[model samples]
Target: MDPQDGYDWQPQQTGYVPPQHRPRAQVPRVDAGRLWAGGAMTALVAALTAVVGLLLIRGVLGIPVFAPEGDGAMGDASTGVLAMGAAFAALVATALLHLLMLATPQPGTFFVWIVTLATAVMVLLPFTTSAPLDARIGSAALYLVIGIAIGSLLSAAGRSATRQDF
Candidate 1:
């Protein structure tokens, strides 16, 4: 006690004090069913995007893509192949997103980067082929559209499927 100020005073105690207990943060949970369902829809959209892009390029624009001009607007079997490939690619991306969500801190950001780089590769792939310049451009544009579709759709799905634990 300080008699002059009429106030109680205490000296600081120094020792090895134990830390206070803290509650651990909960881990975010993911709904696999919802994620997979979104993935399926994304795949369907990707496939359709591929088909429509091909139709627009080949039928409406009269540009040969994935086949010769003599193959007509449908572009032979390659059209179906491209559509299927897009769908498969969507499924694969969805799976990757799922894995990232489970394992990474910012899954969506990583997924976007991965998908964007992959899409860039696909878009540039046509330039490496023996196809004409116009065909390469058209194919590149189509691939870009498909990649955008898949990336966007899957991102939305991932967001919807994630649940924050309080």
Candidate 2:
């Protein structure tokens, strides 16, 4: 019998073993109660921001915004509309942030980008109107302040609502 064909032959074994794959990163969980609470706070802040901004522009500075100069400090019904609009915007932003948190990997980053772009649009929108330059500028400034308040406050709310999964 040939030695190569002999059944007594034993196979060589190596002690080295392949490493196991590392565990995947965990996704974050969102707390709806906390998020909505924070959103409500943000909405209140945004409404106040609109009211105060309008007062500062129309009442203190005596610049006509969202109405004629004859409309006085409060600038007519437009001021109320602006306040309601701001509150509504804040609620919409909250919904967007909530959706982003649930669907995206980097929710905060995306939220900031989205809000920033929306703010830019709002700030630029007044300039397109046929109103006087001062009115346009004042309105734009008011929109800017409102946008900032909403974006910053909602961002904080989103952060507070996120919980990291182990």
Candidate 3:
């Protein structure tokens, strides 16, 4: 070794291969059973979000939940109805995402755009309703929570549901 050279180099064997250059094994995609299970979990999440958000809006925020069509006065919002709506919304989102995954090449991106647009509509719904300002804001906040939960969970679940063959 010459003084100018920092270190000595050893020659590799004729057939030697570098570890980093080796191909990696592919991971198996999630099966349908797992996907459905995830969807069920998403529904549960939506339900819980609805319940908690509604409670916060009505109980903590002191904003009275009311029926939009009926007398525009402070009224009770059925916890059961809220929970059911959230769960149903999540289920529908999941189904739509699944269909998009099966049919489209870029399902995840498309799903995000779709959910975002839907959330925008939900946010705008309060302005159109005749409910009082506080109630409208509260309901819109609830919609935001539900929309976020549905969008994020359904997107992940849909990606998981995608077939490996694709």
Name the candidate that leads on lDDT. 1
- Global lDDT of model 1: 0.91
lDDT of 1 by residue, 1-166 (tens): 4555555544345432222323556879999999999999999999999989988999999999888888888889999999999999999999999999999999999999999999999999999988888899999999999999999999999999999885
TM-scores of all models? 0.85, 0.84, 0.72
lDDT of 3 at 150: 87
**lDDT of prediction 3:** 0.74
Which residue pairs collide, candidate 1? none
Using lDDT as the measure, what is the rank order of every candidate, best first?
1, 2, 3
lDDT (tens digit, per residue) of candidate 2 on 65-142: 888889988878898898999999999999999999999978999999999999999989989989899989998999
Best TM-score among the predictions, by candidate number: 1
Q: Residue 3's C-alpha lDDT in candidate 2?
A: 52
TM-score of 2: 0.84
Clashes of each: 0, 0, 0
lDDT of 3 by residue, 31-149 (tens): 66767778889899999898788667666667776443332222345767878888888878877776776677677898899989998898889879787988888888888888999
